[model samples]
Target: MLNRHIKSHSQYKKHMCTFCGKGFNDTFDLKRHTRTHTGVRPYKCEICSKAFTQRCSLEAHLRKIHGAALHFAYKQRRDKLYICEECGYATHSQEVLHLHLQDNHPSSTFLRKASKKMEMTLQKKQGEDQTENSTADEGSR
Candidate 1:
């Protein structure tokens, strides 16, 4: 089993392909590169009609362009999902969910950030009120 986080770049780490004198980051990437030579298209985009040899690339394109709308139907159908309620898109990972929010739901992202700011403000106000109450008790005694 390969360690997902472990970096093993000695063989194909830097994408050095012996078959066609090309390099890729991963095996799928190498396969995609090989497809360039063989002209094998496995995945096709429904929105833009772009062809890719790997399914991941097609998914990336779909998520990047039609995240909220196009990817909307993807979550329920997918085995694994990262749901983003802000934009209602299901992604493969939380990182992709964040990316979707940034790329597709910018307004919701801003609102979330602004709501956090408001929460901090309220916390600070509560702390100030507690200190004021303590000082008032000290003066009364």
Candidate 2:
């Protein structure tokens, strides 16, 4: 990951954007950068229905985009801003925050709990939708 991040900003830029001629050290960074000009956000969050060009950005959205009030409203608090209990580092992102936690506080179960909550929320919603569909089918018969 460090190599990829470093490669992205290194002086030996290899990949060049076709639209704006901007250069990048890595192809993945170049592809993500191209999305800016294209306005393409293929990655979508199931929880809040937000889209992002990169998976990392979408994960960030899942960690930080929604406020606490809105987060609770949508039951999407998993996407809310995360503040490190160990250090002062804060971000509205997931993978980065997870990395921070793993690096700083190895034994913390916060990430696991957050992930489980999000998964259970999604499962509950799916079950509700299935029940509604089944009821509608029975009514139609």
Candidate 3:
């Protein structure tokens, strides 16, 4: 085989944790993921004052509040989605999964009306389809 010099991340440093021996591409990621084992909360939400151990969780919260569609779009691209064991709801990211666990399985309150929106849209679309079919049948007759 000919020599193939495929370049990789030049500055990539495998930040390894001595406890688990797992490696990451970035030191910041290793620091952040280490909090899972340490049970540390570094980010706090200003709106609800809810604190999270991970920045990813905080980002997901903000995205859910301000960019739900964007977040959903990002989720559909995941290889395997995470489902809530408590409610069987699927999430693409760890943050949303954690949020679902907190909201459904723990002592947490919902700030958004997810069920109301889904119900209203479902009913409205059903009514529109029924009316359209009825009108089309009448016109054909």
Candidate 4:
């Protein structure tokens, strides 16, 4: 992490924001900064419907404003939220997002293709898990 931070300071910024021409060493930082210009607040509060550009900002809002406590196990990160770019719909599960896209935004070709890709990846992962289990079983026997 220290090395990454050091690299960010020393290295030339490769990612540039089109709106303001601000440069960032990291793509994630560039995207986050771009959101400030685009007004694309992806992270939203479920209770108040207030949105934020970053997930951490939303989490802080939930804790401070809504009096919500976010509990995570030691060294465990929060679940990656699947957010709908079309409607600001957010979910913890990709399967839920796939169903949401199918039901609400059937006309979205890009989202549909993304859902299919996710499904294919999941199927591949399941196949790999089964193969590993079978190999382990053979070795144990």
| Best-matching candidate per TM-score | 4
Candidate 2 Cα misplacement greater than 4 A, ranges: 65-141
Sliding window of 10 residues with minimal summed lDDT for model 2: 67-76
lDDT of 2 by residue, 1-141 (tens): 788987866787798888899889886677678778867666668888777766567667777765323334443345455544344455777557777777777776556754565568779999999999999999999
lDDT of 3: 0.58
Model 1 RMSD in Å is 17.1
User: For candidate 4, lDDT tens digit of each residue in 1-141?
Assistant: 676687688558787888788888886687678777757788878899998988889989999999999887776877788766556677888888888888889897537776787979899999999999999999999
Candidate 4 stretches greater than 4 Å from native = 84-141
Better of 1 and 4 by lDDT: 4
Candidate 3 residue lDDT tens string, 1-141: 121122124344457765587776665466556666655564667777776765468769877875633344544553544434333455566456666766666642221333444458679999999999999999999
- Candidates sorted by TM-score, descending order? 4, 2, 1, 3
Q: Please tell me which model should have the higher lDDT, number 2 or number 3.
A: 2
If scored against the real structure, what TM-score would every candidate get? 0.34, 0.41, 0.33, 0.62
Model 4, CA-based lDDT: 0.80
The lDDT for every candidate, in the order shown, is 0.62, 0.68, 0.58, 0.80
Clashing pairs in 2: 62-79, 63-79, 64-92
Q: Between 2 and 3, whose TM-score is larger?
A: 2
The most accurate candidate by lDDT is 4
- Candidate 2's TM-score reads 0.41
lDDT comparison, 1 vs 2, better candidate: 2
TM-score of 3: 0.33
lDDT at residue 112 of model 4 (Cα atoms): 71
